[model samples]
Target: MENSTQINTEKINFSLEDLEQDIWVRLVTGAVKSRNPFHTPCVATMDKGEISLRTVVLRKALAKERELRFHTDIRSPKWKELSLNPSISALFYDAGDRIQLRVKGKAVLHYKNDLTAEAWKNTTSSSRRCYLTLHSPSSFAEIPTSGLSEEIEQENFTLAESEMGYSNFGIVSIQVHSIDWLWLNHAGHRRAFFDYTDGSFQWMIP
Candidate 1:
């Protein structure tokens, strides 16, 4: 008898549009579901001739615009790197589901803008604590430290106190150019590529 996984695999073997839709579904779910593997994707950027990669929380995924959004500190190195070179790449993998998504895009920074304003307004006090750090991320410290003050570290700050972090808070919006989706299954592996710039979708040997 065919198991549920086999039955589900058969359903997934549908039209290209269906596959594309599924990719977006995963992305959208990742933004809201913190436990999801895709919730935090590894983002890559070019920094002074070096390839820099960091994991960031997925804040939003807009299917219609083919864009992904994430919050970051304006003082972070990755922010400066992306500002200098918009070219970016992100990787998402779900071991349980045996799926991987490799995405390429251009990132645009948003600060002191409508996007940042709205994002900061919705951000919780606990989440805002990181932005209130005394020193920027990646900076060397004399000893081990979180770069945050004791008051902020204890989550003793209120919404009004957290407001001070807005100046350092920023957002990175990635305009997706392409997506390479891979699904690994014991029976067979499937790989597909979708290019938004050229509006092309093709399946490749896996």
Candidate 2:
């Protein structure tokens, strides 16, 4: 779920590497990057004074790059919104650990780029083919179209429609401006933020 970035404007700063690392622990302990594929951070935007968030998967962990990324269909509603307003927030929680993290930043979209294509190529044909079925993600239909339904050839459809769908397959990169982390430990609850926009971090009262 990582996207490549060409312009290096800013890198997100964390208050402390240990706490930041601990948050990662909370994520792993909660199987955040694994089974929680759909537990992706909710990207929110202020749509005419109201807020809306959508589920998105964290596809890649570019820690070294100091970045976080996710993947979604380019035609998805969230994608279109981001296209209009790059500023967005990603929210995640680990129920077992009683921890949550929110990152706010500008979003960039990558589709069919060298890196994106590489990831797409590495994906399983079964999953890769799913993108071929439709252009509009989250679009509703009167009925479901399963690979096993209608005695139709799913593989053939994917292969035949690959080009058309590939254009819409995209990865989203969050240009993290700040990260607000809330964690509960043996001592007490702690909330802190790493603000890259100002190049400083502070621990906040939780």
Candidate 3:
């Protein structure tokens, strides 16, 4: 858990291309590794005239396609927002490297489809438990509870139990249109932008 600001920035001088590669490598690696800051990034979405932001776990990253994936309950408000507006943004920051990645993309929801099926199959039972809640997320309740009855909680955490969550489980695949990378350093901060949709990459004023 190194702080990005505390890194000895003087030791590394990265070219634009090199820095871009580093960002993707870290993002892809973070998707497979736990305890990495990039594993949990902030996702923002808009609905009507309002905006919302929340932290979501990164499930997959496809560099070739410039895509990122995350899992969520289909009943959540985020899903409602995304349904109305597919355009979205995500932010990933590595304090140890003094780097921040801002990604803009269009989100495609997958449910009751091959993509969702594959993702659900690979999901751990513990994670699947979230989709098994009796009530939709953020619903008002008389008492604060996980929304699972004691009987359901006592059941074995096996594939059989996970199957019950299939209806609520979903995957959000984001087609990245651009990525803005910023790095803070003692000498001078650097900023670069990569636009996949327009096929352009260049440095920008920080």
Q: Which is the leading candidate under TM-score?
A: 1
User: Cα-based RMSD of the predictions, in order?
Assistant: 3.6, 7.5, 3.2
Candidate 2 differs from the real structure by a C-alpha RMSD in angstroms, to one decimal, of 7.5
TM-score for each of the candidates: 0.94, 0.75, 0.91
- lDDT value, residue 181 of candidate 1: 88
Note the Cα lDDT for every prediction shown: 0.89, 0.65, 0.85
- Clash tally for model 2: 2
In model 3, which range of ten residues has the least summed lDDT? 1-10
Give lDDT: candidate 1, residue 149.
80
**Taking the tens digit of each residue's C-alpha lDDT, what string does model 2 give over 59-133?**
665544556677677777777788877888878876655567887888888877887988777665556555554
Can you tell me which runs of candidate 3 are displaced by over 4 Å?
1-13, 154-157
True-structure Cα RMSD, model 3: 3.2
- Per-residue alpha-carbon lDDT of candidate 3 for residues 99-204, written as tens digits (9 for 90 to 100): 8999999999988999898888888767877899989987999997989877566556668866989999888999999999888988788889999887888999
Predictions ranked by lDDT, top down? 1, 3, 2
The regions of model 2 sitting more than 4 angstroms off are 1-15, 24-33, 36-39, 144-164
Q: Give the higher-TM-score candidate: 1 or 3.
A: 1
Query: Which 10-residue window of candidate 2 scores lowest in summed lDDT?
Result: 1-10
Per-residue lDDT of 46 in model 1: 99
Report the lDDT of model 3 for residue 140: 92
How many backbone clashes does every candidate have?
0, 2, 2
- Cα lDDT, model 3, residue 165: 96
